[model samples]
Target: MFDLAEIIDIPPFSLDRQKKGELFTRALSDLTQYHQQNCHEYNQILQLLGGSKNSFSSIEDIPFIPVRLFKEYELLSVDQAEVIKTMTSSGTTGQSVSKIFLDKYTSTNQTKVLTKLVSSFTGKKRLPMLVIDTKAVLKDRNLFSARGAGILGFSMLGYDVTYALDERMELDWEQINAFIQKHKNEQILLFGFTFMIWEHFYKPLQSKGLQLPFENSILIHGGGWKKLIDEAVDNETYKKRIFEVTGIERIFNYYGMVEQTGSIFMECESGYLHSSIFSDVIIRDYKDFRSLGFGEQGLIQLVSLLPQSYPGHSILTEDIGELLGEDNCSCGRLGKYFKVHGRIKNAEIRGCSDTYAEGKK
Candidate 1:
C-alpha cells in the first residue's frame, strides 16, 4: 500500500535517484491499482491500454494518461459527496477547462506537501506577504481556478497578507506603500503569476519612474511564461527587469499544473527546476512517447503521490522539457533537476497570465 504519511514525513529533496525510484515505484504501483479498483472509467482506460494491476518494476513502467483527459472527462476515485472543492484550470473565454475534484484527504495532503516543498526554499517562518494580483481573483470559494489555487497555496506561508493591485487590476500604490513601510526592516515575501507580476506590477512601476526597496525580500512567481515569451522576454531578462524594478535579488520561479497542485518543481538558485522526493519528472520522445534520457528535449511526464481522490498520480503533460541530471545539480539537491522549454508547438495558449490578459482585452 502507498503510505502518503511516510512520504510526507521525508524531506522533499533528501532522496537520491535510486532511493526515490524505489519509493515511487512502490507507491505509484499501489496507487495505480487503487485507482483501477475505485474508478470505473480509469479502469476501462487501463484495460484498453493493457495495463496490469501487478507491481511495476520501475517508475517508467507505470501507465500514464494524457493530461487533457481531465478536461474531457470527470475522473475521480472518491464519491461525489465527499468532494470538498473543485479546482479548474485557467483558460480563455470559450476554451474548455479541467475540473479536478478534491476530497478532504486529498485537499489536506496537498496543503501539507506544498508547505513542505515551499519551506525548503523559504524557511519555515511565515513572513509578511505582498501579492501582485487583486483579491477579486479569490472571491469564489467553492470553485478555484489555477490562479486562485496558487495564491491560496502560497498564502499559507505568509502573515499580514496584502494585495498589490486593486479590484480593477490596477496597481494599488497606497496599499503597497503601507505594506513596505510597515515591513521595511523585515524580510517579506512576494507572490504572483509570472505575467501578472511583469505586466501589472513591473511594467507599470517602471513606466511611472517608481522603484521599491525590496532587496531584503524574496519573490516567488510562476505560470504564464508563454505570454511573456510572446513578448520576447526570456527568463534571464525577466529576472533582471524584476530586480531593477523591485530590488528583490532572491526570486524563485516554479513550474506546476492544476492536476498536481501541491507537488511543484521549484527552480533552484542554479536556475534548474528540481523534482522533490514526493514527485518526479520524466522527459518523453514526442513521437513515440519513449522515455528520453537526460539532456534530451521532449514532452514532460509528471508523477506525484499527492492525489488520492483522483487518478492524477501519473499524467503526461503537453509541456516540453529536458531532464538535466539526477542527484548532481550544482545546488546540491538530490533527485532530478530539469528545465521546462515551454509548451508543445501547437498547444493552446492557456496559462493563467495568458487567460487574464485575454479577458481584460
Candidate 2:
C-alpha cells in the first residue's frame, strides 16, 4: 500500500530542490508500484509503456496515464467494498463523468492534506465561512459531484457556514445581510468557485451598490478564466470589481481538479500557481510530449503523491499551462510555480467554476 503519512507529513512549500525531488520521486514510485500490484488495468498500462519502479530515475520520468482514462475505467487499488466515498467529475451534457473511488485512508488523508493546504494560506483560525452556492448541494451523501465535493471539502475551514444563494439559483440577500450583520466585526473567509461568486453574487449586488463586511476577510477561489473570458471578465477586472464591493485585496485563486482533489495548487501573493509539497506540475509539448522550459505553453501534467487508493498520482491533464519557475517566485514558497492557460483548444468544457457546472451540484 502507498504510505499516506510519508507524503502528507511534509510542511507546505518548504521542500528544497534535493529534498523535494527525492521525496516526490520516491512517493511516485511507491504509488506506481502499489497501483500496479493491485489494479490490473494500471499494471497493463505500465507494462505496455515499459515502466517499473526499477526504471524511474527522476520525478519527470514517472509514467503518467491520460486523465481521461478514469472516465473509461474503474482504476481503484482497493476492493469495491473498501470504497468509503466516490467522487465524480463535472461533465457537460453527453459527457461521461469520471468516478474516483476513495477508501477510508485515502479519503481521510486527502481531506487532512486539503485542510493543511488551506489553513496554510488562510491561517489556523477557523473563520466564519460564506458559501455562495445554495444549501441544497449537500443534500446527497452518496454519488458526490464535483461542486458538492468542493463545498464540503472547503467547509472544513469554518463553522456556522452561510450559503448565500437560495435553491432556485437566486440571491438570498436577506440571509446574506443577516450573516454579514452578525459577523460584521469578525475576521471571516469568503469561499466560492470563480464564476459562481461573480455571476450569482457579485454582479447582482454590485449593480445595486450592495457591499458586505469583507474588509477583514479573505477570498479563496478556484477554477479558471473561460466563462469570465467569454463574459469579458479577466482576473484583474474581476478582482477590481470585487474590491469595489468588498474592499478585499487578499484574494487567492487555486488550480485543482476532481481527480487530484486533495493536492490543490494555489496562487500565491506573487501571482503564480504553486505546487504544495505533496504535489508538482510539469509542462509538456503537444506534439511529442516533451517537457518544456519556463514561459513556454504546453499541456499541463500534474503529479500528486496523495493518491493511495486510486491510480491518479501522475496524470496528464488536458489543460494548457506554462512553468514560470521553481523556488524563484517572489512569495518565497518552494516547489514549481506555473500558469494554467485553460483547457486545451477543442477540449471538453468542464469544472464547476467554469460554467456553473450544468447538472453537477
Considering every candidate listed, which one attains the maximal lDDT? 1
For candidate 2, lDDT tens digit of each residue in 1-361?
Answer: 3476765666789997789888777778878888899999999998899767654678889999999999999899999999989999888778888999999888888899899999999998899999989989787787888889999999988998999899987899798889988887898898988988888889888889987768888999886568788888877898889988888899999989999998999889988899988889989999999889999999999999778789999999999999989987899898899988878878877788764644443
Question: What ranges in model 1 sit over 4 Å off?
Answer: none
For all predicted structures, in order, the TM-scores are 0.98, 0.96
Q: Model 2 RMSD to the real structure?
A: 1.7
lDDT of 1 by residue, 1-361 (tens): 7878887888899998888899999999999999999899899999999866679899998999999999999999999999999999998878899999999999999999999999999998999999999999898899999999999999999999999999988999899989989998899899999999998999998998888989889999988787788899998999999999888888999999999999999999999999999899989999999999988999999999989999999999999999999999999999899998888877877678878877778
Ten-residue segment with the worst summed lDDT in candidate 2? 352-361
> Candidate 2, which segments miss by more than 4 Å at Cα?
7-9, 357-361
lDDT of 1: 0.92
> Number of clashes in every candidate structure?
0, 0
